[model samples]
Target: MRDAVWRHVDGRGAVCVVGDDFEGERQFEQLGVNPFVLRPGEPMAMYHWEADQEDFLVVSGEAVLIIEGEERQLRAWDFVHCPPNTKHVIVGAGTGPCLVIAIGAREHDSLGFTVDEVAKRHGASVEEETNDGGQAYARFPSREPTAYRDGWLPE
Candidate 1:
């Protein structure tokens, strides 16, 4: 697990479970699974949607969910189900680290990053609508492999 840990340029962290020999690349064919760790105010990813379905479960701490232009508070054990093209993003909230388990289809016909005002308010939106990840995250640093830290999950 530690070997598959990585830190995003934006300070979010994640454990890519089905990675390629610790390179943090998903190795699965049908689905992908990851556990994301986020500090307060940090977003798990840009506000975007895919052509396939996705699901998320809050494992610990708290988070704020921005979906389809609305905001909702999330706590431990909260589960979110997103059908195809349901735009959304999750931001860390409360006083500590937020751990969320994300599961989704590995293949999709399309993906898109949206320019959402609500996501922007939480620093999680792209400057403009785009399907390219590089364009959507142009202002952020790249993710790098990192040593796993303790306490990212509940004991």
Candidate 2:
């Protein structure tokens, strides 16, 4: 990751460093916050809430937003907020890349959540995740990789 500063924006939520300098980018840093540039046909890996605050906004393209059991269509300039502990997912919904901004809090200070919690809420079983360092991402029941056949392949 590159060194970047997170700044506060009044109506725009937060902004942090994202994208290559050539591609352009801004991001936010806060509990439960995460943002990304979604390529076409990219399906967000399903994950659930942990103890932390979270938020989402669409800067470009379009996407299908799933929170709890409800689903909504989002386009450029659209925004959505997921309450802490709510199961949520987002999938690309347009021809172009979906520019999405999301934020999440650290697990220490707030309620912690894992993918399993999110899956359970969404009526699916949870799985475990391991990083290249061989660290377990979730302590609950061990789960499978988000994608079985292809890495980062859209669902």
Candidate 3:
């Protein structure tokens, strides 16, 4: 198999991915397992949830786990689990680029959320990510084939 497909979700959680296509052993469609990596200043998503669950693991560097209505500082090896319909977001915490491994079961029916406090504190311009996932991301650049590979390190 080839390398894992990476999508760089910015602070706004705006992802301009054209399609959900990946060829690998793990069936993301059937198993609903999606893996994502987050770097410094980046996050897995704004605040959103689906029917399935999502979990996170800090492989390297540091990150802040924002869940429910609180922020928890996390370092390497830290793990976080989110049950179904749990509103949560993971943001890179410290100076260095944070390496976070996030996994979640894919669910078509999901909704976005807005956390004013988190947005204000994190300097995120987005208030809420509506159900139209790619609507706001229309102006952003298309996904670069290997762009996320640059964030593979803990810089």
What does the lDDT read for residue 28 in candidate 3?
44
**Ranking according to lDDT, highest score first:** 1, 3, 2
Model 2: per-residue lDDT, tens digit, 42-123? 4444444444556787877787776665667899888777665676666666675666777555454433223444344433
Report the CA-based lDDT of candidate 3 relative to the real structure.
0.59
Give the better candidate number (1 or 3) by lDDT: 1
The C-alpha TM-scores of every prediction are 0.90, 0.51, 0.70
- Which regions of candidate 2 deviate over 4 angstroms? 1-34, 107-155
Best by TM-score: 1
Q: Please, what are the lDDT tens digits per residue for candidate 1 over residues 1-155?
A: 55565555555455544444455455676787778888899898899999999999999999999999999999999999999999999999999989898988867758999999999999999988999988987877777666677777777
* RMSD versus native structure for model 1: 2.0
Model 2: lDDT equals: 0.48
Which candidate do you rate higher for TM-score, 1 or 3? 1
Backbone clash total for model 3 is 3
Model 1 clash count equals 0
